[model samples]
Target: MKVLAIASAGGHWIQLLRLMPAFEQHEIIFASTRQSFSETVSSYKFYAVPDANRWNKFKLIYMGAAISRLVLAVKPDIVVTTGAAPGLMGLLAGKLFGAKTIWVDSIANVEKLSLSGRLALLFADRTYTQWEGLATPKVHYHGNVLS
Candidate 1:
């Protein structure tokens, strides 16, 4: 099974990297925003997407397009993400392209989700919360792999 691992940057990227072992046997693709590690991540099959924040319409549209292209190209069997806006876009695109999706809310979102997590819940085939307290029908209580 092919897998696409996605995140934003900084902490989320570190978290996604930790989960890499889970899908090592599969074809892997990585994506995140352009950050200091941009060049580093490029060593793998990585993609650049716009980073969406509280309010960034242009970045959001660019990210959506980038995700569409990446999804079509990689054609992953599954998509997994650690929260942030870009990851949410990937999850949506993955589902649209007929891939199973997994969304892991960042440890930073223990008490409440970031905006991306909200969007993820609507599209992710399985949504996970690092904190047990945040567990809901749509969220599983998974301990933080990033921690």
Candidate 2:
């Protein structure tokens, strides 16, 4: 399997890395907003994308375009993320191109699914919340990366 594992910086990136073992059997491609993160996954492919948020409309568009390009270029069999907006862009792009997509809500969002997670529910093939209580019929809880 070819997996595109992506996230934003900070906690989102950390959580995505924690899921690395799950991709060990496959070819994994990593992506994030920080180019420096390439050092962390030096053995695999890494892409640096623009960072965006709900507050930044123009940057969000750029991020979506960048992510879309990456997905088209890589054509991953699956796209998984612990997200912010960048990861959501990946999920959507992956979906549009026939790749299965997963959205793993961050452990920090204990009370609710993050905004990106909610948006992802519409497109991702599967959606999960780190907190079990947050799981619904559509959102699943299958443990957490932080654990």
TM-score of every model? 0.90, 0.98
**Model 2 compared with the native: what TM-score?**
0.98
Residue 78 of candidate 2: its Cα lDDT? 99
- The residue-level lDDT of candidate 2 at 29 comes to 97
Query: For residues 3-121, what per-residue lDDT tens digits would candidate 2 score against the true structure?
Result: 99999999999999999998899999999999999999999999999998989899889889989999999999999999989999999999999999999999999899998988998
Model 2 CA lDDT for position 137: 95
Write the residue-wise lDDT of candidate 1 on 1-147 in tens digits: 889888888888888888887888888888888656556656678777678765878878987888889889999999999968788888999999999999988888867876778878877899988889989888898587865
Best by lDDT: 2
- Clashes counted in candidate 1 amount to 0
lDDT of 2 at 79: 97
